[model samples]
Target: MSGEEYRIGLIHATMNSVQPILDAFQVHAPQVTLVNFMDESLIYELNETGIVTRNMARRLLNLVEKAVMGGVEGVLLTCSSFTPVVAEISHLFEIPVLSADLSMLEKAIDMGNRIGVIATVEAAGPTTKTLLETISSNKQKDVIIQTVIIPKAFHALQNGNRSKHDELIHQKVQELNRDCDVILFAQFSMVRALETLDFTTVPILTSPEISVKSIIAEITKRRIVI
Candidate 1:
């Protein structure tokens, strides 16, 4: 990248994950400009279907297309539930397309074979576990993944009770710490809960910071500057 500012587009499935990613960008890659496209309905729809429908895939593609047309150097899909779809069509775009959880998952796998995934949303737990398994398979590593979902935590977050949300997630993390080599927060929104708690048992991985760093690396690698 020359002297121009790099622009990155973020595709979010919910409003809950936006602020944490933005805050992470501000701290880690302050020079990069961020453009966010949020479709809160996508998460609800995916939760109901338990799979990515054709229409939902099309909507995600359209969002990426819009970001490319708007001159973004890279696109980050901040929804773990749609990672499979994003991975499928990522090659179609010339710009780098990254899943929010992949970077964190890689780190978790590298750290240990027994991984613990904690999610507030039911869909996120399975989706993230599958992604981790797939990635580990490709790397020729056999890993054991344990997933825990706290539906009420998500409900509390949606209702604006961040304290309750954090408390619930923190409790789960403490329980998983004894059994897991590393803990992965399955959703970007859940990463915020880490800020208020102190856990010394295992390394807790979150998506936003790791994903931001990955996107910045891609932008720098391609020398793409806005």
Candidate 2:
């Protein structure tokens, strides 16, 4: 609420996540300033290994430390595959440190009993599933999680075939329609696929915009406390 613009540090594992989040901030919280730190190799390693090892989580923690030292009001990790690292390290920081999917997954649990998670990355599906289950358990809600992983769609996106990537995700969303009460795009990169399904009855959620709002709220709360 002050004239000073809030600065948020965005840590990314891939370039695909960068723009969608920037677009989200532009549309939802234009007054905030954003700084980005990207390590493309993180995504490559995760894709190759199909897991976030301790070394990878350590690298992400280092990035967040750097961002905090740079004086950001909050830190947002834009990759879904590494969301757990936020829970592990956020308490170490004075400012808000967030996982891109935390708010979206929590919201999904509140909105429905049957939640659908669609991800293009192999690591993202299980990461999201675990997060969804944890959030539901913490909230004391019973829910069913359906995760669909399409690695080929990520390959198509990497090859610059955006249309094919979106098409693949859209087809899977159609199949999950009858079974799910809400669907979530697990990665910021998957937000583009939302454009393809205009008539779906199931509620579809994406992380970037909602996550931006969550971080801003956290920043505001901290500011008030100070």
Among the numbered candidates, top TM-score falls to: 2
Among all candidates shown, the one with the greatest lDDT: 2
| Per-residue lDDT of model 2, residues 99-199, tens digit only | 99998998999999999989999999999999899989999999999999999999999999999999999988998998999999999999998976666
lDDT for 58 (candidate 2)? 90
- Per-model RMSD to reference: 2.2, 1.4
Candidate 1 ranges with C-alpha deviation above 4 Å: 1-4, 224-226
Q: Please, what are the lDDT tens digits per residue for candidate 1 over residues 41-135?
A: 89888777878899999999999999999999899999888888877889999889998888889889899999999998878899899888888
Model 1 clash tally? 1
- TM-scores across all candidates? 0.94, 0.96
**By summed lDDT, which 10 consecutive residues of candidate 2 come out lowest?**
1-10
Candidate 1 CA-lDDT value: 0.88
Model 2, residue 83: distance off in Å is 0.5
